[model samples]
Target: MHAFVVGVAHYPYVGKGLGTGPARRLLDDLGQVTVPEPSAREIAEWLLTAPRQPDDPPIGTVEVLISAPHPVKVRASGGAPVEVESAVHENFRAAFRRWLRRCEASRDNVAIFYFCGHGWRHGDQLLLLEDLGEDPELVLANSVDLGVLRARMHLTGPRLQAYFVDACREVPMDLTLSGSRPRALVDVPEPDGPLHPVDAPVFFSTAMGHSAFGDGGAATPYTEGVIAALEGLGACRKGGQWAVTTSSLAAHLQNIIDWNQVGEGNQEVRIEGQWAGRGVLHSLAGAPMVPFRIGCSPPGTPLPERVTARAMISPSPVSSVQVFEANQGHLSAGFYEIDVAYPPDSRFTGDTILWQIDPPNEVLSLTVRSRLPDRS
Candidate 1:
């Protein structure tokens, strides 16, 4: 698998104090857990040396680009020091694009993109890059759009693609600006050509319009859970090796954050896109349990106002209740019918819905068919 990883704690032009103090301070204290550097480093480490059963296919050439500032100093023979300026937007963007080129050359491989930094989602998701001094208001231009990035990477035709974003999508409300909000440097262009369907699973630390917590003085709960899960902990053992699909890992990651009460309010982690049956992320040794499959239909069915759908839980008796939106209903030992009512104002056209089952931390994918006649 090839990886492009970035973690940023500072932006030179965006005034040192941009967002919430507590949150910023958490990141500043590198040793205090919620720091971005450690999280980025650990995640890259795991991907580089992914643990697998001896019988499983050996991992292929793993390439990575990590852009987080480390305190390590490098001295040159001529007395000049070599410093890594990772946060610069232009520098990081070049590195990211280079990684994409390498990935394109190796089509038959798994690709992963991990970004942990100060970011906010607008139009698409943006990862703030360190750039030469530019207007603070034009931060968007210096940033990279995750949606566009995903599309470009999808063109490489990797067997599997995974994106992990660990950043706060919160806007800095207290900032003094010349206008209501800043505009993106490059106007987000209309898709003039065919759009590639994103089949990879994307994971976020928190839901929309919320913040993710790092280190209450330890490894931020989100990254810690991910590391533990990837390390073969809490995974179901299958055929002498631990079994964990990408979907199952998503549920497990969510459970870890929720159980630990990581973030404030409803800091639910979200998993989007599709993962085939037990989309095997990696298999190692852990607790022995078979990962169950959760299925929904008519797959990408559309809804007008109210719709009835079926959810089938394999191996039966998974959970007492199924959760969607804010409502919950009891599930029998097997399949159960669910009635969903979409609000009139809810703009769910071409959107993925997150369905969860407690006790058995399982996730099912369901899509809201687009309403536009052409989209249908």
Candidate 2:
């Protein structure tokens, strides 16, 4: 599994430098904070959370981080200068190296990469906004070319590939309260197929097109969203690969802040041989990867995965009720390995009905706190 980031804020940015401004913005966005200052409570909330995406069962070993934060400082809509410094790329590179070392543990065994600079979208094509774009400093794609990306994912083994983006187009726009919300999706069309045998899963902080907002000090919406959805959720264990639905986490982020960037949808790749449709799951060890079938039932949940059970007892005067733990993300009716049984809750305590589970051991019970809360 790997994590890649590309942040661009300022360049030739009123001649302020190169990468510092956007670097801060990237950090703040991943950190979910704003410049000059951010909320303390948000910081605390993000700090306590952990990475919730399941990526375990060791697929060989190679973690990479690409940092491209080219500061192209310019005033946002409010005449406020965005802080982007070229030197910040060096800082992020060092941070990424350290991060790679900390996660991979074996220095000699890890694959590491970091880049930061300016990027621009020319029609459907995404290009770097580096000084070289004008035929001078030699600009390269800050967001690597799909051709290069394919070459890279092939090396990621057939396991999983995870992605995180905190980038927003360096364009200008005005915010309208009553205005239509930015479409949650921004798509860059593929030449043909989306199925990539080397592709596993991807998790992004924000959608494309939209600008991501973060106070100077907090994590950006993307990182903040990851932290919030994963923290204390008790979904992960040591050495396990986890696949989360983009929609579920996207919904969670809606309640946090108004994330500026609206990312494009999934991009599958092309392949050949009998393994043509094979995705990155080919390299996933232990359990076989279940491909997501549109409109059809998805793969079943692994037996080892812990399930989050949400139930409703129908607060009405009914004496009997059913406890349903929705399959939601890929878990199914057949996956409930735990034998859930209930005796009955004939007693109502303080306008509340206490429901009970069986075996004198089932821990789930409904409180009379005004019938059971229905998490519809």
Query: Could you say which candidate leads in lDDT?
Result: 1
lDDT of 2 by residue, 1-376 (tens): 2332333333332232333333323222222112212222232222222222233232232222211232233232334544433323343335444444343443222121222222222222122322222211222212233223334333322332333333333332221111212111113344465543432333323344544344344445445444434331112112354222223333333432222233633221111111221222111222211111111112231221122333333443323232334312321111122222222342212212233221101222222222254479
* Global lDDT of each candidate: 0.54, 0.29
Cα lDDT, model 1, residue 307: 34
Q: Which stretches of candidate 2 lie over 4 Å from their true place?
A: 1-55, 58-119, 123-143, 146-151, 154-156, 170-207, 232-350, 353-376
Highest TM-score, which number?
A: 1
Instruction: Name the lDDT value of residue 156 in candidate 2.
Output: 27
lDDT of 1 by residue, 1-376 (tens): 5667666654454445433443333223222123666676667566655666664444554333334334422232344533434656555656665676666675455667777766665656656554412543433456676777776666554656778888776554322232223323223445677654444888888766667677532445678767765654335545655666576676677765664563454667777654453545667644432122333345645443443435545655333444444322233222444445656566454333433333233333445544444454
Looking at model 1, the pairs that clash are 34-214, 34-215, 87-130, 88-130, 89-129, 89-130, 89-131, 215-220, 242-284
RMSD of 1: 16.1
Model 2 global lDDT (CA atoms, 0 to 1)? 0.29
